[model samples]
Target: MMSSPPAASPQALLRRLLSGVARVFVVPVSADGQLLLHRHESDRHCYWTYPTMQRGTMRTDPATVARRLLREELGAESGVLRLVHVLPAARTHARSAVYAASLDLPAAEILAAREATGTSRRALQGLAVTAETLVALDVRPLAINDLMTTGGIPARTLLALPDLADPASTVNQPG
Candidate 1:
């Protein structure tokens, strides 16, 4: 008997490889509240994304995972972070947490955070581009762009729609 060939697109396969890998999107804002972004080569479809979170080890705890990801991805230190939303397993593989955070650290402070978390190598490759720059690059506007273009729901929650919003919470609760 002949077996059926595997059914998955190349993009789907790559996504599957990255599946179960919890990630975070840090909507880093300037003191003036402008969003900060950077060029991301892996998702070459676009050239930018929010200061994002990537998996560190294999942990899944939201806050811990987020903290670890931030340090690893952004070289950020222990600072206040706000959870904008949590998207649970949208495409059968990974869950993503979207967050907004602020950092007023100086060069020395940022360097310290990098050294403390051993994340210098990653930071060197990323740049602190403002939202405007992202738009200029047409970075596919994952969330905010969707919102602006679609004029419906906020793009952030929309892209991950159906899975958007924390599954466990019914009301706003303090973290």
Candidate 2:
């Protein structure tokens, strides 16, 4: 009979867990200055959130992971994605990385693509909201808002996004 392996120490276990888990949060912005938020039909815990994804491997570039998330979640990829901020493992559950991408397409198109592709784990409904609307709603996973505001992430990186600021011009109306 084969001998059983020794139990892993708590530190080793934590290290293993941390190394295996990698998550990515994507902030998709339309040209009109709207932020894309997604909610799964089955998700009763949270109302909505920025399209979030899991990285396949730790070795994968964050930008690459963000791009894959865009393709998988939105079903369209024509934007320049950049790593805006990274929440270290100590701060986040799974060493989550946050990325921002500017999409030329409107929210409607992105939603249509999501529906057609059906790639997400659950049926996703995308809502495009202005910064003011988002703040007023008080969406779950407050980290998203924090990330935009004073979440320690660079302000300039997200300043370009109109949604991150006060409501200025109405681009894509919230759905």
Candidate 3:
């Protein structure tokens, strides 16, 4: 008689669950309360997105991924990053965690760093804009619209805006 296949191990199940589900996106806030956005060198549209990457089988947490992304893409660091939303995969193989992080550096500085670190394979142009500007732009990647309509962005993010208008304000200063 043929025997039934053994059940999958717990670790194996966890790995399968994590395989394509460990991606993250961030909304990087500048000192002026502007949102950091990226535009591909070959594309004409712009949209807000944090550094994102596949977790693969590394088993790292979302916050850790966000921190690594900040370091790799913007050459900056923050003491705290707040989770805003978790966007499940719509038609893709990966789900995404969204966070809100404040950067103490200038937009130009962050863009310069990104440009210096980015290779042809990941060529991107970084820009910072206020909420009004973001609304005016023809943003792409489609997920951004979902983030807005689905109430993914926390209210705290909007509360932080007024303080950004003042350059000397210490509202989002990193600890």
Candidate 4:
């Protein structure tokens, strides 16, 4: 068998890889200002995340990755994916680009592969969470201009959503 490259070769390559863009975060935003997220826990308290996917190769385009994720993970065929911004992630210690897509309507079934994301389409299976409910996650303040630019959404959207400030309020809702 042929010998593999030196261990230092892999290490050096990783350094170069991490130095640049490493992952893509796809955010689906509804016209009413809600966002698509995933969860694993079925209880009142659960962690959430965007449908994030890794770049297969450095030369791969971010939009391609985002589209692939929507098609593969959620089985969404059509949507206009827009490049939003590149942001740093303290949790992963890597920089990631964020892409947003406008949703005409909610999908009948979301999160096609629960095994992939570790979320069970639980009680609040609705990935389309409102602005008020989003901020409650504490990942970042969704009410701020950042994170899908919540500040730019119409006031009527918020008025249309139920009072989900209380996590328990969603307990009775479907996943």
Best by TM-score: 2
What's each prediction's clash count? 1, 0, 0, 5
Better of 2 and 3 by lDDT: 2
- Report the C-alpha lDDT of model 1 over 57-118, residue by residue, as the tens digit: 65554456656655666566434555555546654224666655544554455555566777
Residues 1-175 of candidate 4: C-alpha lDDT, one tens digit per residue: 9998766554464344345677877666543445556555655756666677888566776677888877665556434555545666566535776666555555444433434554433322344444454555544323222443254342223222332122133221112
lDDT of 3 by residue, 69-110 (tens): 777766678644665555667774357666667777767776
Model 2, TM vs. native: 0.63
Each model's lDDT comes to: 0.48, 0.60, 0.56, 0.51
Q: RMSD of model 4, in Å?
A: 14.5
Query: What ranking emerges by TM-score with the best candidate at the front?
Result: 2, 3, 4, 1
Candidate 1, poorest ten consecutive residues by summed lDDT: 156-165
Worst 10 residues of 4 by lDDT: 165-174
**Better TM-score candidate (2, 3):** 2
Candidate 3 residue pairs in clash (backbone atoms < 3 Å): none
Q: Which candidate comes out best when scored by lDDT? A: 2
lDDT digits (tens) for residues 107-129 of candidate 2? 77777767776767554554544
Better of 1 and 4 by TM-score: 4
For model 1, the superposed segments whose C-alpha errors exceed 4 Å read: 1-21, 30-36, 40-46, 53-59, 88-93, 106-118, 123-134, 144-175
- Per-prediction TM-score: 0.46, 0.63, 0.60, 0.56
> Candidate 2, overall lDDT?
0.60
